[model samples]
Target: MKLTYYPGCSLEGTASDYAAGIAGVAGLLGLTLAELPDWNCCGASAAHSLDAEAARALPIRNLRLAQRIGLDVVAPCALCFNRLKAGAKDLEAKGERLSFRVWDLLDLLTQPVFLKRMAARLVTPLTGLQAVCYYGCLVNRPPKITDAPTPENPGNMEKLLQTLGATPLEWSFKTDCCGAGLAVARPDLIDRLVRRLYDRARRAGAECIVVSCQMCQANLDLPQARISRQAGQKYELPVLYFTELIALALGHPEVPRWLARHLVDPRPVLAAKGLLEIPAPQASG
Candidate 1:
């Protein structure tokens, strides 16, 4: 099960932890990942807004790179997955048939082969952790592009969580927008959106929020304090990446490093569940 991996810009930059977790989990699952050579940005949330042609071209270029390697592409980032799927659709519309497939990591995990491997590798089952799987806006929108069965009510993450011994809570706002890419420009709106998500997750008795998008993680994790302050409430929820949880279940050595990168500390939550040990600070001169 070798695939051309596209880490994309976000995975290389702000979401490097995601990249690590994916790589680690893939290794554990015996899935070989060959990175696309010299790949460029997929022109995420901004590309289509400015120029449709450029947006399509950027991802198509990467798809061609994957084709050269003669393998399907696996993009872990939701925005990257959407852009690549859109690019393939654009080419198909123009009568250009591509030789390979583009798969979101979530889609790949749903396969029986991967699920079997993942179950065998789970040393520490995440028992008693109630979570709401947040799909954000782009992962499964426009049905045709993403090929998601129920875009409004996705269950991929929930299914994956169940296999790892975690409880995926039922809740609304699963597919609602988390103010994607508008964090800086219209934070007021973002705050409101985050608040709604938090309120719902809490109402559903979820201890944390699990997401597949880096943008959603940032909006939900980083702005918690301010959003809480603005709403005259407190939200101490731990927002985690699906990959990170997989790494924890697989007992990956770097799980601590991945957990350390979160804006909202997840150690407390993990510690409470007896799932992690907070490493002691290093002695310094």
Candidate 2:
């Protein structure tokens, strides 16, 4: 199964580990990712707030590129997914009066035929770990932007987790915000937001949080030390990219390498549960 890929800025830079793991697992599962040529930023949150047209146009450009290539696009970032979905929904709804291109990556990947391949390609067996799937804000809120399913309590990630053999935790903060863009401006705000989400995940019995957004993962993983210092308690919850967990199930070689570069290591937990058979490799971060 081949799909056009939009790496966005995060995937090529800070989230390269995730991109690599995803690519590795795709190869192992016989899934092909064709990156859209000349793909640009999806305009993310800032663009949406300032210039809606640019936000829509950015994703539209890539969608049109994908259409020209005669393939569907796959965007791993939750923000990008939300933007693309939003642009596509608007285009389909108003019949081109919006003066912006239209298309969604989700529309392509979730087709019955492709979904069947994705389910069949489930390689990682997350048998023992209980994970809380985190979608943050982009994939759900702002009614016009996302409507693939009800923004509240969507189960796509949970279903995918179950199919990959992981126990999905029933957590209330699954769709809650991790204070993404506020990471730099209002670190305290993010601290509170992350602490709340972490508390919920812990209370719900999740050993880790499975994330599809780079900022969400970084906010959770990078700020734990400060959070612990401020709160006088340690919160060492593992933040695993959804793709990284899927790679482990697919039996990819880079899992260990990816784990090592994390701010909070997940190896000991997987090892303690006797699921850590990933042979260590030279760190690649």
Candidate 3:
């Protein structure tokens, strides 16, 4: 499977580890993600608040570019996927013609086809791992825009993890807002939300919180120290990108590189589960 790939700003910057995992796992899944040429920003957490048209323009231009390549576009960032989906709807309203589709990388990969290859490619299944799949606000909210039938309790990530031999713990905060976009404007709110989410995950019996959003990963991972300091309790829960876990399960050589990019290291937990050792390289089929 081949599609146009849009690595939004966060993917290249804060979410570089996510990008590494994406790159490593694509080959294993027999999927090709061609970067959209001359692609630009997709008006992430900021644009729509100020001007609707201006926000739509950024992703619309990207859609047009994907249309040029005549392939479906895959955006790894939740915000980018949301923006692109909204932009496509805007174009549809204007009676504009386009010849491609936009998909969230998470939604795209969980399809049956990719799911089939995952089982075969499992060099090391995360059998003993237990985590809460954290899907932040933008991924499946506003059901009409995202076309998510089960937006309330989407099991895409859970299903994927089960396929990889990992147990996904259930938690009510699966689609809750992380308040990451408001970190600068209202850090107090971010702290409160992060703390609640962390407390909930811990209470749910999860060893970690696995996420698909850059902002969620950053907000959840980067603030644990401060949260612990303020609350006078240690919250060492690690936040890991779902892709990183996949890459590790697939025994990607770059797995260490990807894990190293995390603010709160996940190696200790992975070590405790005996999942830290890199499997020896295997020849291609």
Candidate 4:
């Protein structure tokens, strides 16, 4: 299906790997993501804290751009999705409305049709890989604003992983804050937050933490070594984007490049699964 794609700020910078996964698997999943041209930032975390008006306005402006394209808007970034959804809610509060719907990338992808396409193209299944899905707040919290079903315990990531043949472990930190918003100003606090998540996930027998948010990935992946050094223990869990794993399962050519950009190396664990190189599927008779 065709849809307007809003990548937000992270995809171009810290989350480029996420972008690559989307690009690699879009066609296989029957998606046509036409980038919203002239799109600007969705005011991520700063605008909402400082200027409420701009927070609403920024995402609204991008939503208008999507409306011009006359298709539903699909924002991959959790912050972007939250911001746009908040803007849409604001429009309704003011008795103004848009012509198109806004969809979080996870919500849109887990639908039956998309799942069918994904299953059809699955040449490799992520069997025996234990992981926990990290929602990182904002995406599904404040459910009235985001309209997420079961915000406290979202199953989108788990369902998607199940379809890919991966075991998604249930954990209490599923929707916990990753401390991304405070990472810069209060790294000491953020470090504690990351440490808690790492220790929890590993204790639950997960080899990695699966995330849909770039901020969460950065928070967990970047400062790992430092945290390990400070604590005198190894918290070596690889924080991975769900898209990266999807691309690997589909044998997407761009998988290696995306995985390389990660700060904490994800290769060893992924390599142990024999997923480093995927063989092209043999032709059917």
* TM of each candidate vs. truth: 0.95, 0.87, 0.95, 0.95
Model 2: per-residue Cα lDDT over 24-58, one tens digit each: 76676566888889988889888988997898898
Candidate 4 regions with alpha-carbon error over 4 angstroms: 278-285
RMSDs, each prediction?
2.1, 3.3, 3.8, 4.4
Which ranges in model 3 have alpha carbons more than 4 Å from their true place?
A: 278-285
Taken over the whole model, the C-alpha lDDT of each candidate is 0.87, 0.76, 0.87, 0.86
Q: Write the per-residue lDDT of candidate 1 for residues 99-130, one digit (tens) a residue.
A: 98899888887688877888987899999999
Candidate 4, 161-222: lDDT as tens digits: 99988899988999988789899999999999889999899888999999888888888999
Q: Is candidate 2 or candidate 3 better by TM-score?
A: 3
Measured by TM-score, how close is model 1 to the native structure? 0.95
Error of 2 at 34 (Å): 0.9
What candidate 1 gets wrong by more than 4 Å, as runs, is 278-285
lDDT of 4: 0.86
